[model samples]
Target: MTNNDPKTQYNGIILLTSYLQRVFVAETIYQRVKKGHLGIRYSEAKALLDETYTILPVVEKTKQLSVAQKAQLQLITEKTLALMKGYFKQMPLSFNDKLALVGSSLYGEQMMNNGVIRLGKLFNVEVNKDFHMRTQFYEDRTKMVDFLVNSIHHNEQPDVNLVKPIETWVVDILRQKDYVLADMNKISEMIGF
Candidate 1:
């Protein structure tokens, strides 16, 4: 009855899936799967991957996957994490991108149907995926943090105004957390993928 781990794991899995979708986005699921080395879950690795799943937080806990599907997804997650580790090993996430992801996750977790990030989009600057592939920087934080904010006095395009604040917010949250960056593998495993 006190099954809280699923919700936590589910959130982490959704984050990973969202990140993978960005990395492996292509014209078709087949192409995406190939690009990611079949690392992403087959069902979710579509060209039109759901961005909301990544940005939002947990409300209701996830229903259990069918036994067969669970096994398949576990293998997929292993592959996916392997690929992710390789990229992360090249150059760790920029502080800004980490903020975006944390903000997005916070926004999603509060609502049964959250859309804070959508509002943030009105003021966001795009993260350059092309630059990521070229430099292997894997720049993806701005793409995630459409979620939440405290106040927005201006009503114009923000360029990079909100960028630094987001990073600050994330650190504020992390300071309150029990874990740090070294616990990343635990976060991934908590997904139970």
Candidate 2:
């Protein structure tokens, strides 16, 4: 069957899971900024949050997704977006200002994961822990890309010297998973959590 066939909702779920993981990592970075531990600027954090909002719709389109899209959106809207709006209202962004934003972002992540789990249950597909681990590997690659982009934007040479090995490792892991999924003849086995 083709990749876009209905049975491949399993693959779609994996794609959605990966997207949520990126959002989760972005939230973590935002948390570090709020805690005075990182230098991520307010505008930068806002842009990341906005990007996440945009991606949420795409993630909500999974075929087996039974959770109300509105409910999922509401969770993030009430938590993450509200905090961002409140922070922007304040005169100066302070540590305390960031606390709400950080909390909201974290809560949003949990809500998203719960929604994914619910979707998996609806499809009788287990969301594997390996898939979760793969998300971290994907996040590592994302960080590498962000580092390269930032370096280039600052008129500095993008460092490729240390990235090759990591890239190879990530690609290998993904390929291994793809092979595992391809070999599975049953959806239950493919999604075995």
TM-score of each: 0.33, 0.31
Which sections of candidate 1 miss by over 4 Å?
1-6, 25-62, 89-184, 191-193
**How big is the positional error of residue 35 in model 2, measured in Å on the Cα after superposition?**
35
lDDT for each residue of candidate 1 in 1-193, tens digit (9 for 90 to 100): 1223544444444544544443343212222212233434333443223433422332222244334544544555555555444332122544434543454334323321112232123225343444234322222332334321212112333346556666676666546433323443553455554
CA lDDT of each prediction against the hidden true structure: 0.38, 0.42
Clashing pairs in 2: none
Candidate 2's residue-wise lDDT over 73-96, tens digit each?
Answer: 334333432333323223343322
Return the lDDT, model 2, position 7: 33
lDDT of 2 at 68: 55
Instruction: Report the Cα RMSD per candidate.
Output: 13.9, 14.3
